[model samples]
Target: MSASTEQPEHLRRSLSNRHLQLIALGGAIGTGLFMGSGKTISLAGPSILLVYLIIGVMLFFVMRAMGELLLSNLQYKSFIDFSTDLLGPWAGFFCGWTYWFCWIVTAIAEVIAIAAYVQFWLPHLAPWIPALLCVLLLLSLNLATVKMFGELEFWFALIKIVAIVALVVVGFALVAWGFHSPAGNKATLANLWNDGGLFPHGLSGFFAGFQIAVFAFVGIELVGTTAAETADPRRNLPKAINSIPVRIIIFYVLALAAIMAVTPWRLVEADKSPFVELFVLAGVPAAASLINFVVLTSATSSANSGMFSTSRMLYGLADEDHAPKPFARLSKAAVPSLGLLFSCFCLLLGAALIYLVPNLLTAFTLVTTLSAVLFMFVWSLILCAYMAYRRKRPQQHADSTYKMPGGVFMCWVCLAFFAFVLVLLCLQADTRAALLASPVWFVLLGIGYALKSRRAGKPDQAGS
Candidate 1:
């Protein structure tokens, strides 16, 4: 693609209401649920259901706060915009770049996951091949137009929704019929409590589950990035945000419950996906392969979302002079081509990581833990910005049509919950390493922000 004589100044608002809805849906249902739920079920047992509920409810409030703030000013393209406006330029600088890193880390994990999924069919295939191929395919597709990305996510999310619904329905029928697996495990609701019960592994196990479960929700806030291109955000954004709880219950809680009921919690494989195993246990002909294909697409969908989000974030940062000025340029399609290529170049490292890390699960946990920790920072910044918005813009809050349910109080509550999850990260060895490495990102960002401020001959708000 080449630049035209007439260059558009901004991203086009071509994404429609349906696009926003499915994008939000795609964001809400992340790769973690499909790829990581087995480990969560094994660690937390049936108590994992309660874990999802707590996280879901808390994130719903976070979304509500984000929605209110984004709608309060149409000028805000994403949460980073509000972070900068409500907090300071330093907040925007840090938030924008950290968010960009967050998605890159997440896309790395998704690519590794895609390679693992491919190995289900070809056990000897080089993991890097699929990983590299996925990145290149996403780069080509995203470079076309923003609307194309939306269309891809729309279908990807739809496939996931249908697959989960089918899994639930089939699981219920098997349980009703008292279907017994080859291993002699009987299908029944009693499976939830028959073995060591919900907290069988104790509270320690339940707490350990949060580390990976937090990764499950990594992309939940993705819709916030669509504010710039979404058509009728006021009408569409609220619709997407309000339905999060429902989607969580149906897509996550119900699907996992059905899987556990069919296969029993004790029998779930830690490293393998339960979504595919459930069908294999039920003796569904070629069904496991079909489900594997669904999960592959699911991971691909997540990688696509990551690519779209990271490029746009870089674009936002450049437009504000927080990044290289050339990153601000757009292609004929109104897409940030240079930023997208830069993100893809970074993603290629993920392929190398796959080739280097012999233990796939370890690589996944490391990247995901780091990704989750950064995402929590981004979420905290949103809450902090919401508190600032409340203090600085009381008149706007009072006059606004859609208000956050608990306002500033819930912001504090969400922030506290995040802090607690961060503390939980210290429990495990793998997660602890990621946690220890996290502060280095902030240190680098602080130094970069200070230098940039000095070059511009402005007060270093980041240092202040």
Candidate 2:
């Protein structure tokens, strides 16, 4: 294909390398590390770090495979589009809609969590107020130019990065300077395994952590969805992807290690945030207030990312004729206005649900677990798509600029790892409830697809 033939005028690349870099970083760091780490530590003790490392390695290869497929076809704006072309319509439709649902569900949880975070300062305030404000704030931001979205995400991500770096630095200082609690214990690495080895709860505890550990990595693939708008995707895309492993190690593994070192893993509370607890333990009277600010921003960043990604997924689906054509429309600023508004409207349901169910913990558990289930489904599809691509396009595989190492074998391994995580979900009662509740989403998608197919069969416009 010639250069002009390969490139399309309608699709412009507007994201710079800096934007791509920060997008990847923004995608990786979220409420998971800021708030969810406490729960994960409670489940598996210090061994949770190992679980995170394993999951990170598996997802790294999965992303490499996706990047390889995406870089090969300029027409592929998202993984779902590439899957459809390489596999079939079914793969495309399923991947696109499922991934969109994943974001919506995850966004709802983030919004509700944000409301809860805000309540720390204003205990008497109504939750719905903050949730509504968050939705509107993110919606307005998303309606602006894609470059503006990139800029907003850059600052949001910077806050998270700086917070984590500060935590690590302060934690190490406490350990080195021999800071002691009233109980007379100095912070040190010994906290990780001294009380009862790393796996204090035993091997079963380590395995159990996988259920929540996987959720931490849910939005890591957001970089893949941004390919359509990335400037010089060939160079910038690889640079963004190459940072995944390093970021995972820094943000998840090392960050967690530092937290567990400063305080014993067993002391971390499942219901309270570990970041807040670390500050409180360090004798900062306003730690709760400071951490609340960080958690609030983290929640906003996650919701902002959800809106951006869900809209792009809709745009890709429309481009592939899997979704309504209206969703493909772009605003003057190159934003997917229709899709953005639709997703923002859907997010309002989160506020409504929070009003109905005032029990914050219960509501958070239901939405987040469901989000994890859907994310697993999407990741499975990516692995399956890669496997299909390898089988059907051997020559493309041979000449690809970016390739998945140990192609077929790694593909199978990732798929199996996902399968194992699913089984673990089923074994855990909370996650199992989510698994039972998730099929309704697929059923709804099936009904929608059937109606759409019927509408397209009419005589008015079957032939383009």
Candidate 3:
């Protein structure tokens, strides 16, 4: 593509290598690792280790394919950008909008999490006050400039990274000294096997863990979204992607292993955060609230990320003429002002609904369920889009220095892996409900695409 054909970028390329690196960690180490790990351990026992490994390996391929694709065309902003040309305009429209919706649902969940978490500090405070305030503060930070967004994410991610490193260090000390947990379980490597062996729930339980583990990786593909606004996509993006193995090791694998070693997997609770549980263990004064503060910041961090990415996605959609024209317009600060405000409004509305709902728990579950289903669609789009890039641009592939490791073979493997996740989705009731309702979003997108194409006096284009 020539410069004449290149898409215009109004958003500033202000994010640096440090910003990108920490942003990757920020997105990866959110509520999923902090809160959801408890449930995963409860279901899969020590086998959750394998579950994280499998999902991380599969997603690494997905990111490898994405890194190659994004670097293949600097003109492309997000995965959806090239999907429009390589796949079809509809591919861009469907996946781009679906991604926006995914973040919206995720942001809502995080907002509710913030509200509930703040209650741990003030027992009688209204949920809506802190939730609305959190959204407004995050929105103001995002609206300032891309750099402000970067700064906010940097500090938030720093907290998470520091917390994880502390957890690993503290946990290892606990295990090395032979510290016994409050429940009388000894902190040792043997705890992994001493409690009914690794596969306590057998193969069935192992597969069941994927249902939750998959969503734990929802934002792992985030760097690909920063292609246009990143200072040096070639160097910084790959550095962030290359560190995935180490990240999985330290953040997910070792952290969980440390937790299980300190407190046996059998003693872990499904309903509570293992971090808080362990911090509040014997001889730790006020550690529970400290961990709770970390959890609150983690939730706020996730929502902050959702706000930043969702606005950019909307801007991409509008720049491509897939969305309203105003969304493409940028502020004097070179930010997508319209898109950012719109996303923030939707977040506030969603938060308000959650606050007013008769059953806040039910609302939170519904939002999470939808987020998982749509994130699956968005990730699959990345794989399918990579496949299309490979088939359609052979010369480009041959010229590229950073290519997917297995090439086309791994693309098929990743798709098959996703198909297997869908099967697991159906095996559970919450995920099953989400799988069934998954059609509603796609159907709406299909209708919207058809109408837009009709108005354009062109036939609807479909992706292979």
**Top model number, TM-score:** 3
Winning model by lDDT: 1
Residue 7 lDDT, candidate 3, scale 0-100: 33
Q: TM-scores of all models?
A: 0.94, 0.93, 0.95
Please give the distance, in angstroms, between residue 277's alpha carbon in candidate 2 and its true position after superposition.
2.3
List, residue by residue over 128-190, the lDDT tens digit for candidate 1.
888888888899999999999999999999999998898889888999999988888899999
lDDT winner, 1 or 3: 1
lDDT digits (tens) for residues 332-448 of candidate 3? 667787888999899888888776776877746756877887887888888888888888899999999898899889988988998899988888887788788889989999899
Q: Which 10 consecutive residues of model 1 have the lowest summed lDDT?
A: 455-464
- From the highest lDDT down, the ranking of the candidates is 1, 3, 2
By TM-score, how accurate is candidate 3? 0.95
Candidate 2 regions with alpha-carbon error over 4 angstroms: 1-11, 357-364, 458-464
User: Whole-model Cα lDDT per candidate?
Assistant: 0.88, 0.84, 0.86
